[model samples]
Target: MKTAVEKAADTDYRELSVSPHLITEAKSALMHFERLCGRYQQMYNTQVQANKLFVVKAKNARMYISHFVQVLYMSIQRTEIKEEHLSLYGLEECNMIVPDISTNEQLLEWGRKIIEGENIRISRGAVPIYNPSIAKVKVMYTLFKEGYQTQKLHQKATTRVQDEVAAYREKVDKLILDIWEEVEKDNMDLATDQRLDRNRQYGVIYYYRKGERV
Candidate 1:
């Protein structure tokens, strides 16, 4: 005696009823949410750790630079030596006072110029010297500069990525909350009458009576 429309509606309502499958699906959603949240947390933690590491590296780099500069300052401070003293001096070997100098690339370029007999104005009135070893020092200096700049850029990029990832995680969390609210609203009858837990994460649980399609 039931009309086709009434039968269809009844079927739909039955399908909407709470079920174990819905609970499983909701639990899965919560797990997914937990995973996403954990991912963000891990990324944030990694960035923090990286920053700490950079601080240590930066300090070490500074120390090396200071040591190299000290050596150069000492060499220049030798007032006893005049132009003649250096004129007789051959190219001194360039040593890495610091494993990496911030301006090493620039120094390297300068080194190449030195090799090519590039004009190196020592004192305001001093003539350019074409020393093989001095060219090497310039090259090393250039390398240091390049290395420092590159590392600094990388650090900034890493920080930016971390921030973006964190923001994304927050947005996803909000979406999950909204989804849960919507599911709760649409299935209030089942949630309230069935005494089902509506606060679960993910979509609402749709249950079917025994021998039901859902």
Candidate 2:
């Protein structure tokens, strides 16, 4: 997202450094377009900041769940449950390590199992596994679930903003094209390559194929 806005900014900045005569002919108008793109880039930043908040919160939640599962698995040694049913306590196949690719949904599911299994065990006179009780762990999972939903909403909103940025880019590109076209028209008598070279002085970029040059 930042890249898209920054690219448009770069183009506008370069084009603003145009040939001297264009000061009266086009430079002021060019500044207007530059400011238009700048305004949209600022708008895009608001969405960027909002999306970052959700991303950071989601990461924190994932980290907590991963840690909680790992700690619970290690504490399973103090439990009376047999190895075959260890997954009921959220230990994956009785292993103490959480998978590297575990997602928020998967982590939340593990949290559910940990609380339920722990509660059942507590009912039967089983000692609590770790220092943070299952009740407290349940609280963490509940908060984590809430954050997951918030993260989803933010992601969707950010996607919509990204589409708007795309539209803004197109609008800016058209403005640039109009300016470049007028500049070319003003130099219509010059040879094509010569005229293009003149436009380059106004920061009008031209693309070349691989291994090609001016």
Candidate 3:
């Protein structure tokens, strides 16, 4: 449970015999690693926001299309078409007798395509630096490992810092990967809903249980 700052202090030269040059190098490397962590966090936030917006817009578009087709189906059910109603509803092209079942099926097909397109877009829109950041963290971690291996003085202090750096890198890499995994899972769920009636509607519902928290 050692904090990252505490681990950094461990390598900041506790031994009187440790050279100032080595201490300076270690401090500088740690600072750079922290800065990279900040950048990675910012990148992650941006990507999450982008993903949310993309999904929301897609849902809105699908809703609009579904509603439009529903309206068209309802209009076609009329026994006689009126001139005023025709102009008001703009039902010129939709004047023909279109079955409700066929209309719903077309809407479902459109929804599937929308989801498929979104999956492709999400796959292509992944942050370019995501993987490279993990690689950079691994490289930065090697500095501490090498220092720990060669240190003549404060061996225990160096070891603590080296292990901490490794842990930090692993944590960061896992976080980035987890975010990517969530996005992929979301897209997969959308694509898989093609067979379900939920896709034709507004997707799966989260019904309220009696005691469940909102």
Candidate 4:
């Protein structure tokens, strides 16, 4: 006959119906997802930082040119300069010119287009590898499900194991309580005899025939 403790231990040992192949496939799927998230996040941060730095440098360049133009205009005004007098500033001929792109908005828009182009190139390069990785994850999931059977069956088996464990624990506890109660009763009977002997040793004795004093 199996002891209560042995039965309890057996109840705790549950055989998983899931196959090792399914576990390996599931892990591969998780790893793929992790890599995809990490790679995309890294690329996104790099592109954003690059774009911001490009915009900042362009703005600084524009500011420096604007300051130089303003100083030149003020000096020309103070000297009572005419259009032809611009030759001193390295110009053979003087003519008023209007620029096609002369605003901060236009500069920012051009920077955005460059950033977009770079992102497109990166995405195009990744497409061949990215699409296949996604398909592999899908295939792995299908195989994992086939190996493990249905989700409902897995859940029912798990619940059954849990119930067995609970019942085994209950039986183990009752067995322990019964053993303890028997030991405690024997200890109580021994304790009464011990108390009487201890009293006699301390010189307080009781006798039925006559009074014995110590």
RMSD of each: 13.4, 8.1, 28.5, 25.7
Clash pairs, candidate 4, are none
Per-residue lDDT of candidate 3, residues 55-168 (tens digit)? 444444444544543443453465322333332323344454322322333534444442343234336663212222323333333333333233323444445555566767
List TM-scores for all candidates, in order: 0.37, 0.53, 0.30, 0.28
Q: Going through the candidates in order, what is the number of backbone clashes in each?
A: 24, 0, 0, 0
Report every candidate's CA lDDT: 0.45, 0.60, 0.40, 0.39
Off by over 4 Å in 2: 1-87, 90-92, 96-105, 123-127, 189-214
Displacement of the residue 203 alpha carbon in candidate 4, Å: 77
TM-score of 2: 0.53
The residue-level lDDT of candidate 3 at 121 comes to 32
For residue 13, model 1's alpha carbon misses the true position, in angstroms, by 11
Error of 3 at 180 (Å): 33
lDDT of 3: 0.40
lDDT of 1 by residue, 20-133 (tens): 344344445545555665665666666567556555544544444345344443554564224233222222333323223344353344334333322333444443432223
User: Which residue runs does candidate 1 get wrong by more than 4 Å?
Assistant: 1-65, 72-78, 81-140, 159-174, 186-198, 201-214
Model 3 clashing residue pairs (backbone): none
